[model samples]
Target: MNALPALPDSPGAYRWFYADVTAGEYSAVFIFMVGSLFSPRYSARVKRGALPLEHCAVNFALYHRGVSRRWVLSEYPQASVLRQGRELRIGRSRLEYAPDGTVRMEVDERCAPLGKAVRARLVLEPQVPAAEELQLVPGLPHFWRALAPRAKARLDVLSEDVSVEGIGYHDGNHGAELLGARLPRWHWARVHGPEETVVDYHLPDGVAPLRVTAGVLGTKSERRPLLSEARPTSLTGWGLRVPAQLYSGNTVVGTPRLLESSPFYARVEARRDGLDVMGEVADFRRFHSPFIRWMAHFRTRVERAA
Candidate 1:
């Protein structure tokens, strides 16, 4: 009968570093993540005189060409680590940072599903200073989130024989618990404008007492919080609901266009306040157990504006 720690102290605690790059009409997202989870049958196994243990994994996802092609790689128990605040490597692919504040990412992955190799080399230079870390949940389980809203990127993708040079964004999150554990439902979006960037995060029922409705808007040199809102409009061909409008206070600033949709998530690009908004909204309940999904179905309703 002891109290569990608010955040896990083990090295195997859940955490992830993510970066996203977009240029013209092409985009790519990268994730270097690790997590530890207890088996759902732990109680049953313990009752049968078996020790309850934890499972850990290192996973990464690369969404190429606006989510048209996605490559996922995972290693159990994690085989990679961040070194010197500069390099992150898993297997052979790695993302590194230079002393001059430039980032380089080299990818050479053989994807079995595509029956081919996906290769790319990308360089990103910050066009603005890093933004202050945004705390999703204030205390105890405070998951730290940070953003670099704008950067100039030069990319050469060997797989598609495509080359792109333009602006990009980078964000990171580190926490002791999985995101699903912290926030059951939320909508996260990022807008890359001609001169500035905007990030809107909404958590309806996850953050407790006060609904989590916050936004950051600014250029690289400056940023300010804004009053914002998000609403899903209609279901697209991919079966994911599209946002009708993104509001900054009482004015509609963006209109969403679906870019990709899967069983539980949707990626969209919107024209917002004369800028371009691109990001995803996901429903984690579908990925959970059937009981959890059923409970979610009863407790949540997908709303659409008429």
Candidate 2:
């Protein structure tokens, strides 16, 4: 089991646990966030010297046949979040890990703008062992780890009659300072096969890229791109360019289809090839714009404690 690690408590420090699972015709992704890296509220409050835990949040999305079925991005106050080594709870939802490498996620959240319920229960069993943590930037406190690069997952939506089983992934990132304050943009992709998984992350400022391959044998990671190859791709409606096709090593993974798009970020998936890619062009820098911060409110929901 991979328990939650010690989190930083300074203002603007952030921590988050992210997981995604893809099954036949259905897929889902969820995250538990402290400091809420993408939160407009966090961005504003941190400037005022507020604690990172004060802006915690839970984000979950369910998809069917490549279309978004239910989306939730609910932010909570510091009083509503509870963190422990083996468990972390936000509102009525929680994430728990067992000694046998089983991870269970309980989600009871609501869609933004409207308060519609989006409840789900997901179970993930790690098939491949956890990998080591790597520092992203030099002299920076930010770090990332692929806790479970490969896992067997099952999902059930409690709000409706839905259940499925398939491949899944779990990872985490923690930092003592704001992510955008150090990096301008990044691109990341994960390609999976029956037994092996590959993760490629691109960073700016000449920092080395993180490429990892994990399976039963062990975990192998590279810090640099194999060669100077940047393939051409198209631009999103929001002006963010993304990779149309993903490559790991010398193998052509597959073409990607856009799942979500924004002025600073893009999420694409090559479901046929068993992989997904997420990219951020200028999220933090543009986030400083007043107009951009106002736009973010529409994508988030704020629920008061009962």
Q: What does candidate 2's lDDT look like per residue over 1-306, in tens digits?
A: 556676568998989888888888887888888888768888877778978777778888887876887888888875333444788887777888877779888889888868688889889998887778888777888888988888899999988678899888888889887767877677777777766888887777667789878888987766874347666777778767677676655666566666666776666676445444432234566675677778889888886643
Judged by whole-model lDDT over C-alpha atoms, candidate 2 comes out at 0.77
> Candidate 2: TM-score?
0.92
Model 1 over residues 57-114: C-alpha lDDT tens digits? 2222344443556453333322333554467555556767677777776766554223
Question: Against the true structure, what is each candidate's TM-score?
Answer: 0.68, 0.92
Please list the residue runs of candidate 2 whose C-alpha ends up more than 4 Å from where it truly belongs after superposition: 79-84, 273-282
**What is the RMSD of candidate 2?**
2.2
What's the lDDT for residue 23 in model 2?
81
Could you tell me which residue pairs clash in candidate 1?
none
